[model samples]
Target chain A: MIVIELSERQLKIIEIVKENEPITSEQIAQFLKVTRATLRPDLAILTMSGMLDARPKVGYLYSGNNTVSIISEHVKRTKVSEIKSMPVVVDEQTTLYDALVSLFLEDVGSIYVLSHGYLAGVISRKDFLKNIMGGTDIHKMPVGLIMTRMPNIVTTYPHETALEAAIKIIEHEVDSLPVVEKFEEKGKEYFKVVGKVSKTNITRLFVELGRQK
Target chain B: MIVIELSERQLKIIEIVKENEPITSEQIAQFLKVTRATLRPDLAILTMSGMLDARPKVGYLYSGNNTVSIISEHVKRTKVSEIKSMPVVVDEQTTLYDALVSLFLEDVGSIYVLSHGYLAGVISRKDFLKNIMGGTDIHKMPVGLIMTRMPNIVTTYPHETALEAAIKIIEHEVDSLPVVEKFEEKGKEYFKVVGKVSKTNITRLFVELGRQK
Candidate 1:
C-alpha cells in the first residue's frame, strides 16, 4: 500500500481554511460555490489526513502540524545520479529482430540507441510491439527507422533526483528515461548515455519511504 | 513535479544513523559493505533532504522531523470511489478494430471488457498494438479472444483509497484500473464496474498535495 496525498480539491479546501480559520463546512462550500454534500469527501479526506480538525458547531480548523513533510524535501534534494541504473544500449543499425531479441533477453522495457558511443534515440516494448503487430519484416528493418530519436527523447542527468525523473516519465508518458551527461563533441553539444530511470524506480522509493517510521 | 520519497537505501542509512547517533560517514559505509566514496551520494541526499545533519568531526545525526508525512495515512483513508472516473467500456463481442476505434475515440488508454454489463476482462493500447503488430485480422477477431481475463485481472473496490489503486497499477504494470463494487448475482459473487483510475490520477494527487503547506 502507498500513502495518499491531499487531492486538488482538498488542497483548495485547506487553502481556504488557512485564510479563514475555524471556518464551517457550509462556509467552505459557499467559498467553493458548491453544495455541502459535494464537499463531504474533500472534508473527510482533510480531516482524516489531520490537515484539518472539526467539531460540531466549532467549524473546521487547520491543524497545520504537518510541517516539513518528507517527500517535498526529498524530491528537491535528490539528484538524478543517485538512483539511476546503467542503460540498456543497442546500436541503431541493429535489425528489429536482433533488437527484439535483445529486449526480451535483457528483460528491459527499453533500449537506448547509440551511434559511436553517444545517445541517439530510444526504442521500447511499445515500439517493437507496434512494429511486430504491424507485420514489419523484423529481420530486415533497422531499429533506428522506428526509434524515437533525440531532441524528442526525454532525458535526465545524474545530478537530478528521482523525483524529477518521475515527473518526466509521467509527463512524457514513457516507461523509462535515459540518464545522460552532457559533453561537447566536435563543436556540437551531445548527451552521452550514462544511465536510466523508470516509473518502477520512483514507485519503489514511495514504498520504501512509507515503510519508514 | 512529483513528490520524492526516500529510496530504500536512504531509509536504511537513516535507520542506521538513528541507531548510532553521531556516527561517522565511514561507519555508515562500513555497515553497508561499500566504500565511503560509494556512500557519498546517499549521504549527500540525506543531509540535503534534512533527514541527517553532519559535522566535520561529529559524523552524522538523524534530523528525523518529517512528522507530517502524507502518504501512509492518506492511502489508508481515501477510497477508490473518491477518485475514480467513468470507465470506458466495450462489449466482449466487439471486434478488435471497433474496440481499437473506441479506445482511440474515447482517448482512453484502456477499455473494460463487459459481458452483459459485468466486467469480464480488460484490453489496453498495448493489447491492441500487440495484436495489430502481430498481423492478426482485427476485423475478424473479437477483443475477448486476446484480452486479459477475470480472476487474473487486478481490480479495486470503490471503498479502497487511491493509494491501493496506485500500488495495484505499479505492481501489475497496468496503465489504469477498473474501480469495482462486489454484488451477489444469482448466489454468485460478481464485481460491478463502477469507475476507473489511472497512474495520472495518482501522480496528479501527489503534485497537488506537495504544492500545499
Candidate 2:
C-alpha cells in the first residue's frame, strides 16, 4: 500500500511545514503564493489522510510513518558529526572564470562562500552564467559580489531522508543542496563542508534503491 | 587539467595510437569482450581533430571529430517519439480480492497482460512482491485467469519518453514495461509493441543539458 498519500498540492503543503512547522494556515496561503480557498481542500485531504497532526495552537506538521519519523529524528540528532573537506567556499569575491573551472572540474553545481569558516554566501552555475553572459569582467570580479547569501537558502543534516533531500530539490527548484555539519554550542565544525545531493543524483539513487526490491 | 582519462586496463596499451579517437578495435577482438587491447587503434592518430576521414587500410577509423557525427546521426535520430497511453487492461477472471483490495485500495503496483484484445497476465504489488518474496502461488497462476482486465492497465502514447513516465513515481520500480502506441512500417498509428527499456532507465541519462559559461 502507498504509505505517504498526499497529492502534489498536498505535498506542497507538507513541504511548507518542513520549512517551519507550527505555522498558521494563513501563513501557508501566503507562503505558497496560493489562496486559502484553494489551500483548504488540499489541507483537508492531508488531514484526512492523517499525514498531518493538527492542534489548537500548532498549525501543521508532518506525521509520517513511524519508521520514517523515527529514522528522520535519529538522523537529525546526528547532523554532520565532522566535515571532511576544508570548505573552500566560492563567494562574490571568487572570479567567474575560476568558479566555472572549479565547478566543472569538481562536478559540483554550487560552492559555498565562507567568511572565517562560516557560510557567508553561495554561488551557483546559473548565477555565474547570468552575470558572465551580461559581458561582465568575470575574470576580475570576485564571486562573493554575485553570490546568494544566507537565509534565502535551505539546508538539512546528514541524517535527513534522501526523500527530504529529493523534496527540497523539487520544492526549491535548485539543482543541489549543500550538506552541512551543524554544530551544537560553540561551533565545533563551523560547517566546514560535507557533501551535496543534486537532483540528478537524487533521481538515480532512488531508482537504484527501488531495483533492490 | 584532468590527466588520467583511461581506466586501469586502458593504461597498459602497447602502442600509443590515438589520444581519444573512436577506433573499431572490435574487428580484432570486438566480440571477445575480454580486454580493450584486443582491438587495434585507428592508424594511431591520423590527421584527426576535425581533419581526418575514414577509409579502408587505415587502421580502424578516422581520428576526426566523430562527436558531431554522433550527435547529428545517432543521438538525435534515436529518440522516443509520439507517446500514447494503453487502456488499463486486466483479465475478468482475476479474484476481486487482488483488484479492489490490492491494486485499487492498497495501490499495489500496476500491471498488464494483453494478447490481441484478450488481455492476459497481470501486474500488481502482489505479483512482484510475491515473486520477490518467493511466493510460488503467482508463478502457477495465469494473469488472464486472475487479471483486472481491459480498461484497467495504464498505457501511453508514442511522443512520450518512457523514461519520463517511469520516473513519475520517483520511487516505485516497474518490472513489466508499458505498451506505447507508435508508428510501425507504414506510419501506422497502431502500436507494434516496440522494444522495452528498464527500471534502470539507465541510458545513463543524467547530465543537465544547457549552455555553459
Candidate 3:
C-alpha cells in the first residue's frame, strides 16, 4: 500500500462531489473551468482511493471514507505473535522473594506463575510492593498466595492482533498480558503461557513505526 | 494526507521503473501494452507519492521511498503536548510511605519528586519495591533518600514530538518521562514538572490510531 498527499485540485473535487452528488465529470469540469481531460487524473485518484464512488452513468458520490482508515488498517494487520517478547515465568510454589529476584533479573514488569505446567496466576511489581508494605512475609509465602489468579487475568493469543492486545491493556488497566495457548485435559480447559505482550512492546513498535527510513 | 492501496498496475509500473531507470511514460505504456493516456493517472500517483522522481528530460527514476515513511510522518506530526497526562508529584521531603500512597491513589507507575517547586527526582514502583526489600524505613525515610535524582531523569518538553519522547523512553528503559520546562536561576538550571508521558500514553495513542473508523 502507498500513501499519497491529496493535491489541492483533488481535494476540491472531493468537496464539489460532497456538495453535489451524482454530478458528472463534464459538470465538475465546467465548474472548475477545466476540460474533462484535465480533471481525469484527479477524478481517477479520488475514486481509486475510495474517497469518491463513481456510478454507472451517474457521476460521483462522496464515499465518506476518511484518511484515518488507512492508518488503522496498517496497525491492525500487525499480529501479536510478531512482536510479543519472552515472558518471565515462575512455578507457583516459588517463594515471593525468589519471584521478586527473577523479576529484577529479567527486568520485566510482571511475571506469570504456573501450576502443573499450566498458567495459574500473574504477579506484578505493584502487587509485590503492596504486599511488602502490608507486611506479608515475602521469604515464606508462595507467589501464588498473592498473585492475581487465572480466569481474572487478561490474556491474548498468538493469532491476536497487536491492536487488540493494546486495547486490552488500556481498557483493563493492566501493565502486560500473558500470551497463552489453550489446552484440554480431562474435559477441562487451561492456558499455557507462551509469551508476553506489554506496553513496552507496543511502545517499541510505535517507535519503529515512527522511525524515518 | 490520504493513503491508497497502489493498484496492481501501479506496482508493476514501480517494478518496471526500478529495473529500468529514466524510462519515459511512452516506454512504460508500450511495455504494458497500454496507451500513454491509460498510464497518466498511474504516473501522476507515482510522482505525487514521491515513490518515483521525474526529471524534466530524464523520464522516471525510482525514488526508494517506502510505505513506512508515510506512517512515520503521521506519527511524528503528533506533539507531546497533545497527549501528555497529569503527572503525579510529591515533595522531596515527603516520607516514602506517603509518596507510595500518592502513587497508589493516582495509579501511575512513576512519581516526580519536587524540591521548592522544581523537579528534584523520580521514583518508580521498582524503586519502592527494592527499597522495601532492602529493609528501608519507609515511614521514616524521605523520598529524596531513595529516589533517582535530578540530572539523571529522562524528560520531554511540550514542543517535542511524541515519537521523540517514545524513543527516549525505550532507550532509557524507563516507564515514564516528566514533561518539564527548563528554567535558569542564579546560573543554575532546574526543571519544573508540568505533565508526564508514559508507555501507557504511547500505547493509548497506538490504539487510537489503529481503531477502525
Candidate 4:
C-alpha cells in the first residue's frame, strides 16, 4: 500500500470539485491556471484514491470518501499470534495466596486458572483485592472459587486479527484476554491457554505503529 | 492526508526502477509496453510519495523508503486532551479501604491522590494488592502511606501527544498517567490532576484508528 500526502494543488482540486460537481477536467485546469497535461497526474491520483468520481462524457464529482481506510487495513492485517505475550497460569487447586504470588512474580494483571490441564477460569488483581477486602481466607481458598469461569470469559485465537482481540477487550470491559487453542473430548469443548493479549499489548503495538518509519 | 492503494502498473513501475537505477521514463514505458503519456501519472505518484527519486537528466532511482510514515504522522497528531478521561482522585488522608471503594465505584485502574487540591501521589490495583498481601491495615492506613508520590509520577499535559503518553506508560511500567496542569506557588512547582490516560485510552484510540473511514 502506498500512502501519499496530497499536494496543495490536489487539495485545491478537491475543494473545487466539491463546490462544482460534474465539472470537466478542462474547467478544473482553467480554474487552477495550469495546463491540462500538468493536471493529468493530480486528477489520476484523486480518481484512483476514490476521492473523486470521473464519468465518461460527463465530468468529475466529489465521492465524499476522502478519509483513511488504508490505516484500518494496515491495523487489521496484524494477527494475534504475532503480538501475544506469555500467559501466567495456575492450577485450580492452587490457593488464592499462591496465585497472588504468581501474579506479583510475573508482574501481570491476570492469571489463567487450569483444571486437569485445561482452562477452567481466570483471576485478576481486582478479584484478589475484592476477596481480600471481603476477608476471605486466601491461604485456604482455591483460585477457582472466585475466578470468572470459562464459557463466560472472552477469548481470542492465533489466526484472529489483533483488531478483533482489542475489540473484545473493550466491549467486555476486561483488562486481558487468554489466547487459547480449542480441544474436544467426549462431546465436550475445552480450551488450552496458549498466550495472553492485554491492553498492554495493544498499547505497545500503538506505540510501535507511531514509531514506524 | 490521502492514502491510496497503488495500482498494479504503479507497483510494476517501482519494481522496474529498483532493478535499473537512473532509468528514464521512456525506458520504463518501453519495459511495460505503454506510452509515456499512459505512464505519466504512475511515475508522478511513485516520485511524489518518495518511493522513487527523480533527477534532472538522471531518470528515476529507487529511494528505498516505501514504508508507512504517514501512519505515524497521523497518530502523533492526536493530543492527550482530546482523549483523556475523568480522573479518579482522592485525598491523601483517605483510608486505603475508602480509596479502594472509590476505585471500584469509578471502575478505574488507578487513583490519583491529591493534597491541598494538587496531585500528591498515584495508586493502582497492583499497589493495593501488594500492600494487602503484606497485611497492611486498609481501614486504618491512609493512602498517602503507600501511594507512589509526586515528582516520581509520570505525567502528561493537555498539549502533549498521545504517542508521548503511551511511551511513558510503556517505559515506566505504569498503568495510568495523570493529565496535569502546572502551578507555581512560592517557587514550588505543583500539579493539579485534570484527567487520566491509561493503556485503555491508547487501546481505544487504536481501535478508533483501525475503524477510521
Q: Which structure among the candidates has the greatest DockQ?
A: 4
> What is the overall TM-score of model 2 with all chains considered together?
0.34
- Using lDDT as the measure, the top candidate is 4
Q: Between the candidate structures 1 and 3, which one is better when assessed by TM-score?
A: 3
Worst 10 residues of 1 chain B by lDDT: B67-76
Interface RMSD in angstroms for candidate 3 = 2.4
Q: lDDT of model 3 at residue B39?
A: 96
Candidate 2 residues B74-190, lDDT tens each? 112223442222334444444433343334432223545556533344565434333322333532455565454444434433454534444542434333345555444566333
Give one clash count per candidate, in the order shown: 16, 44, 0, 0
Off by over 4 Å in 3: A7-39, A50-67, A70-74, B7-36, B50-66, B72-74
lDDT pick, better of 1 and 4: 4
B153: Cα error in model 1, Å: 0.7
DockQ comparison, 1 vs 2, better candidate: 1
Ranking by DockQ: 4, 3, 1, 2
User: What TM-score against the true fold does each predicted structure earn?
Assistant: 0.63, 0.34, 0.85, 0.93
Question: Scored by CA lDDT, what does every candidate get?
Answer: 0.74, 0.46, 0.90, 0.91
DockQ versus reference, model 2: 0.01
Error of 1 at B33 (Å): 41
lDDT of 3 by residue, A1-213 (tens): 667778888888989999999899999998899999898888888888889999978889999975545463456678899999999999988999999999999999999999998999999999998887788899999998999997999999999999899999999999999999999989999999899999999999998877745
Better of 3 and 4 by DockQ: 4
**Range of the 10 consecutive residues with the lowest summed lDDT in candidate 2 chain B:** B204-213
